[model samples]
Target: MGTDVNRKAKHILIVGGGYVGLYTALRLQRRLSRELRDGSVRITLATPESYMTYQPFLPEAAAGNLSPRHVVAPLRRVLPKVRIINGKITKVNHAAKTATFQPADGPRRDIAYDIIVMAAGSISRTLPIPGLTDIGIGFRTVGEAIGLRNRVLHQLDVAESVDDPDLRRRALTFVVVGAGFAGVEALAELEDMSRDSIRYYRNLSPRDLRWVLVEATDRVLPEVGPEMGRWTLEQLRERGIDVRLNTRLESCVGGKVVLSDGDVFEADTLVWTAGVRANPIIESSDLPIDERGRIKTTTWLTVAGVRDAFAAGDIAGVPDATNPGRFCAPNAQHAVRQAKVLADNIVRTLRGEELVGYRHRYVGSVAGLGLHKGVANVYGIKLRGFPAWFMHRTYHLSRMPTFNRKVRVVVDWTLALLFKRETISLGEIHHPRDEFRAAVATGRKH
Candidate 1:
């Protein structure tokens, strides 16, 4: 039976709490009319995390320039009216109007809804390289950022105390496999942090650390134009970063990284930021998907031939109205803008109004290569050095979700300028139970 217009309230179910899901709900919550707001609609958002991570700041977070907690918007705190479920939606039974979800601590359960928003964003795209799973870490979430920082600092501690040459070398070497914004920013920021941190350790010096970046394609920072890309390469190389162009990481077996360029080396840390694919959950859903496994949506951000279903962000292939033949790029700018359109369209659909198409022109790209260094090209205006770096900070700071978060991020930057970057690594945070387990085992042996 259809949603009873007279008695039952319409339920809006959002599958993921990332950029699209969170923003769409926020818009809808604010724009809904007084009558509908009272009790006509119920918005339920189900996500793996209770917070939405501002991913662009992950590099700075890793370098301890910003607090990891401040980089995420807690859904419960931000969206008080929306029902937030700390669970993952495993499958969507659209035909039956039911969705199955498994909570972190409970068995699978199903919920019925009148509308479904498929905003289940992307996951790390990994290759089947040997030992990759055992050694590699991704740079997608706040947890990964924190863990990487801890591991990097911990490795320095190990290198300082270890006397074995091979062990020391392995501990000192750091490899990042990707050259996009995520990879480049992460490498630069972490390198800067590590260099500054080395002064505290008398045994370690700047020269002792080796930072390597491997990209499968010809150049790094492809989002930025060629000129800025070249400038980024030169800047990174000048700072002692090994930028391996046209190179691929074949295998990372036993901590030894085998590259396509015939180079093999042992490294203690391997960060995989190569790329991302749509969330695998979409594949199982009965939706029309593109070749890359993204849900096929019209320019208006609605799933083609599906009623009361909408999608956007990295998971949906919405054709770009501005660029006739192509789809919108999977980036924060597009995701945020498309969410606005998607939200408005949802409202329009409810009001029986015409939906508008999603259209956005390619703005520009920017990358920060450590502190006081960056590259950018905004509306054909090229820039590099500290100017670009300032632009990077300015743009992201303004676009950060909430005003509170924006203020906090500014406070972080201001404090960073006044004080020094924090260098302490809480590696044990990830394995808090390990030491307790070890002690229990020791007592049993005794």
Candidate 2:
């Protein structure tokens, strides 16, 4: 009877490569090593990228304080026992126990599995303001962070080289929408980097740059509470950053920013870090989802009213047991912790044991506002300035995926203290084949 129970073969399919997907797989690999070795259990993770990006460090990476490569962990190296597929799980047919996998360079195919983990994370939630799509960029991925860095530095170069005052003014104006963690940190880091870079340019000065932050809400960093948010606002205003609260971006037609307060300006750079919505892939699946489009999950991390299906992270509407009548916030704090519980439950189910529910108290929030500046509220303990900044770094460093990545990030920070931030923009990297194409055309003519 024992051998029969242990010999049962099962396959687990995990979709998405973000925090929940990566961590859950890591935990399951360790828990099911014997089953894997005996060919009684198999795990396959499908993700759009081969590596998992630690989004919390993106701001530092954008400011050139950390290398881009160090912010992401290669999934293959971390999960050697699991099968990694570089693709997207386009759709999940739970009734049929199969998911449609669309590989990076091939036709779509169906993957059969005994259990499915819907870890497909959220995407940037965008609005339909005029010219917003054309002019705006987001700060979710490492590419966007590094790209925004290049764009900012490139704009400075344009401003310096141009003789037209209007063009130069437009080039120097940077507008960031939303005052959440992403928007605030991104604005602060880039502004700090740009301020440091101005000393090298003879024509540009700190006064020449205009940094504007637009938000519809009356406060910033709502996660840290109103008092700390107010403090953060004051700090930014003191740094000459224009913080517009309770205001809406009416439009940005032809680079002309028309605000709800009748303010008008031309800005070449517009960053939209407002929010994110659950991945549309959830809609394609047969899983039951809430009105917000997130898969409804029980405290045990299992999909509501569905057998052999589980979900966690930003894509799941997981009820917060700690806060009655509320769901868990879509953040790294919940995702990381929930993943451990999720993995353990899966192991329990395989062993015919009782599953465990996931519950954890909200620890609080921490945010970095450039070098030696930050705000944090941990367990109701409020902190600001250098102390908060140090706490933010230490907490995130402790959470950063692997020890290998943690060491690289520390080295990057140490080097930044010894050297000035590099402001050179390698924009040509976005179009590497352009020069080769031009050469080919010349060769054909010759």
Candidate 3:
């Protein structure tokens, strides 16, 4: 009877191995001493990738300041005690305490869990625009970031080799939709890289390149206050970047961008980093969610109307304790902090201890505007240029997961200081199957 009961260990299954999932599991694995040793509790983490991407480093990665591998932490290495299942949870039945998981190449399977942590994160929230599918690329994943870097460099090469004015003009132009941190940082980094790489090509110069940032809002970097936003706009404009404020992308058909403000332009590259929506998997779950499709949670981060079900990070609509009638903004700072509190509360629930509410005030924002230039607003004190740039790097370096990853990223930065940033475009990395397809065709012909 004792063995039978022990065999039925309470399984804590966490979906999405992003910020919340990794941090929560790290805490639980360290805290679940007696429960784990006696087989009374077990933790499992399910995610599409075996690694977690440190999204803040994406801009730096694209600029080749940090290697792509250093920005991602492998789940297996980080969460050794927890069962790392490489899959995605398609649906959740909280009433039954079971979830349906689909592996990369395997059939669907039902996983029973005593506790569920919904941290599936968010996906790029895009609008319905013509040719968006064909011409636009998102800046959410590491693959996308690296691909964008290669594509930008390849366009430089294309412009240098081509004689046609139309082709050269299209190849040299780059359009970025959105003025958020991701969009702005990506644009700045890529543009800086292109500027540095201009001397390598005889036909391509800084004048031949056109980088445009389109934002529907009147100001950019709204997280950094209106004053700072305007300062950033002026800085970008001074750097010859076209900052289109209060503008929206009407269409992007065949490398032609039609703006809502009666402007039309041709560009070969269109990067979309407008916004993100909560993972759609939350809707399929039998849990209380807000109108925005995020799991409705109390201040303590427990799922409302559901027992043993909790959520944090982007997927959880956690009430803002500091401000009533509002929810916490979905950002990395809140996500990482909430994961810690949520883990403690989960342990408290198991021990029948009191739970504490989660509350955090907005602590301002920081952004990098190309190399050695940035903007920051922390505790109402504003900073710009190299000081903000150093703060941006220092802050993210400290937040990056694992000592090993930190060392690797620092090494990449150190090497960059000693050597110039590599500008070669390895475009074939994305099309790994092309060689196989060509080989198959030749074999059939023979």
Candidate 4:
């Protein structure tokens, strides 16, 4: 079967630029190349950013082991045939076959499409903890990762410059809430970076810095199973990291962190990797969503009972065909694979052929704990320390979008082995306009 040549042109609108959007569109570009060239099928990808961030590398990016730029692939470059819109689809009116497109700047407009792919991925799931909005930072984006790195290094500088004991103590303490893959890896990597940086500081030592990991649950890396999780917990504790399990962050009003265990301390830096929720933008769409606000999707990766509409990744509650009574876990592993099936299914739909369902066995999990440290349980085989770390890097490097980024990341890693990791803080980049504003104020005063 093939696409009907007599039918009208079809437009495929893809929402979000994460794994699902990028991979699906890339596949469609190849699968429907003839249609795209003939103007019979059009693909438009609308996302907040022009680049798709490879989130797994975010921890290494924060640790200065990978360049921030290398952690993302430009959407335009990757999908040359697909029209890339550096904006967001604010609302989806599937009944009307139109979506509200809100650009990074300027007025909103409605776009018409024959089919829509809901890939508007998840966002940092924050809590109502006091002062969290004022003080805490998430580890989701490249900006946040790099900003946390600068904040950590800047805290070191603050400790070195200050003579007050109380202030120094606060400056040296770093707290991370959540011991999941993101939380643990981020804490471990930054701690390793800070420890390496201590040798360059005159008044600082590794002992002076306090690193804490607080998880509401009793274990870490739950996806890797209890055995590997317990092993990982032991490894972290052995590195002098304060792993506080069964603890919730009661409050962080001011820099004072109050834990559920009745422990209170002042920390200058607080990193929140607690969790992520589906992008609330999904609420505006007229689609069937699950209890968690994720769009309901079938095993074929199509929106449940909604023809010509698809969803995958964190935004979709796609049922696991391999595992009954459960949905696929929201991870890169599943997202990447689902995209392939999703793209193939779309082509099948276009050709008036039977669509295929997505089904894959759980391959296990892998997570990095700073340089030369990691844990992995792929295909029921367990590995720890350098082997795990090597596997983590190798697996992620291969999965990273585009060969250019993969080579750049490898070069960054290669350079790290030959030289020391750069610990310089560029916090000023966060407030670049501050210097200009100060100059204007000075001129007014003069």
True-structure RMSD, every candidate: 2.3, 3.5, 2.6, 3.4
Per-residue lDDT of candidate 1, residues 1-446 (tens digit): 12213337788889999889889989988887453568988888999999999898899899998999889988988888898998888888788788888888867788888888999899999999998999999999999999999999999999999889899899989999999999999999999999999999988899999999999998989899898898889989999999999999999988999999999999989999999999988867887888878998999899989998999999999898888888899999899998899989988888899999988998998888888888999999999999999999999888888999999999998999999888887999998999999999999999
Clashing pairs in 4: none
- List model 2 lDDT by residue over 1-446, tens digit each: 01112224698999999999999999999999999999899999999999999999999999999999999999999999999999888888899888888888868788888888989899999888999998999999998999999999999999999999999999999999999999999999999999998888999999999999999999999999999999999999999999999999989988999999999999999999999999999889899999888999999999999988999999999999999899999999999999999999999988889999989899999999998899999999999999999999999999999999999999999998898888899888878999999999999999
lDDT of candidate 3 over 204-315, digit per residue (tens): 7799889999999888998899999899999899989998988999998887899999998899899999999999998788898899889899998999987899999999
Identify the runs in model 1 with alpha carbons over 4 angstroms from their true place.
1-7, 33-36
Q: Report the lDDT tens digits of candidate 4 across residue range 373-424.
A: 9999999999999999999999999999999998999999999999988999
- For all candidates in order, the CA lDDT equals 0.90, 0.94, 0.91, 0.92
TM-score on alpha carbons, each prediction: 0.97, 0.97, 0.97, 0.97
Give the least accurate 10-residue stretch of model 4, judged by summed lDDT.
Answer: 1-10
Comparison by TM-score, 1 against 4, better one:
4
Clashing pairs in 2: none
Better of 2 and 4 by lDDT: 2
Lowest summed lDDT across 10 adjacent residues in model 2 is found at 1-10
* Model 2 TM-score, all chains together: 0.97
lDDT of 1: 0.90
Candidate 3: what lDDT?
A: 0.91
